[model samples]
Target: MDFSLSGLWHEMGLFARLVVIVMGIMSVTSLLVVGERLLVSFKGMSDSKVFASKLASLLADGPGRLDAAADTKFGKDIGYLGRTLRAGLVAYKGSVHGDKDLCFESVARALERQQARELAVLKRGHGWLATVGSTAPFVGLLGTTMGIITAFEKMAASGSGGLGTVSAGIAEALLTTAFGLLTAIPAVMAFNYLAGWVDARAVDISEASNEFLDLVARRLADGPSEEEEEGEESEAAA
Candidate 1:
């Protein structure tokens, strides 16, 4: 019997073939997920840098600038920071006329909620990657185990204990394990990389959120800006 990959494949039992197919699917899916996540992360980073620059200028003028700037078009697909800030801004605008403490608290809660949501979005495919990484080897091992059993059965049937009788089957079984490892290694690496990115982004989000809250606090302490007072008076007159 032949022992090359094609030969081994031909010699493989149905279960072994199935295991290989499953591993192939896992590898493809993992690659797709990794590619998608990397693209998103990179794009988000770029968008966020631009958004941050704009935000910094607006913030320099005071949080009141956000009231008018809120309606300004950033882009359709802003990054995590943009989305989170937008949420907080909306909350702040809505509650600005209410109690000062409540307004601050409302923005704080909105920022927190937006942070959680952004993290969740970033982690979308992480579970599948983790599952593939942790289980692919075991799945391959199962195929290997079954292949070994078949090899032994063949040896018994042929009434031959010689290595040649079972070597082919053993090799075929081991191929599944190799496939499993191949599928798992990339997944694990991708998962680790993605996790690090997520952690770093989380820190960015936290710091940005805190800075925003401080800005809000300072704006409140200094009293409402003339523009805000004018808006309020206009509303009262109407």
Candidate 2:
């Protein structure tokens, strides 16, 4: 009895083949999702660091530059952080004559909305990876159950209790189980890895938003810069 790959493949019944095919499709889908997720997560992480540094520089100039950050390519490339900050900045800058508390509330709301949207973008395709991880094994088990049923049917039809008679079905059952696990393990690992990255990124975005809000609050409390005061005094003298 040959247990080589080719021999096992030859023993696989139609149901086992179908199971293998389904697993193959799942594997391909999971791989694509993993690749896409890695790209998005890495790019977001990289851009976020750049955005943070540039934002610090811009804020050092004063809160007046918060609105201007959105127009720059650095802000645009900063992914979630940029978008979230832009939302708050726009709200803060627009609420000029409105109540200060209202303005702060607006910025916080904007930050929350942008954060949710960006997190959704980061989490895209994660559900599929999770589905594949959880279900592939069960699907394989279904194939194994079918194989066992076929083995019993064959024994009943042949009226013989020989090991050779049942070996083929058992081989098919084992193959499906093997393929199932092979497809599932990587998907589960990738899902966990990507999920962790996303969570960390979310935390970073949230913290950055909080920091931006604090800066905005402090700037508002400090009033206009010396440059603005000097210009006002000059105009009065003129």
- Put down candidate 1 lDDT per residue, 144-202, tens digits, no spaces: 99989999999999999899999978998899999999999999999999999999999
Misplaced by over 4 Å in model 1 are: 234-238
Candidate 2 lDDT at 177 equals 89
Q: What tens-digit string does per-residue lDDT give for candidate 2 at 50-100?
A: 777877887788766654654455535767787788788788767733676
**TM-score for each of the candidates:** 0.95, 0.89
- Residue 79's lDDT within candidate 2 is 70
In terms of TM-score, the best-performing candidate is 1
Flag regions of model 2 displaced more than 4 Å: 61-75, 224-238
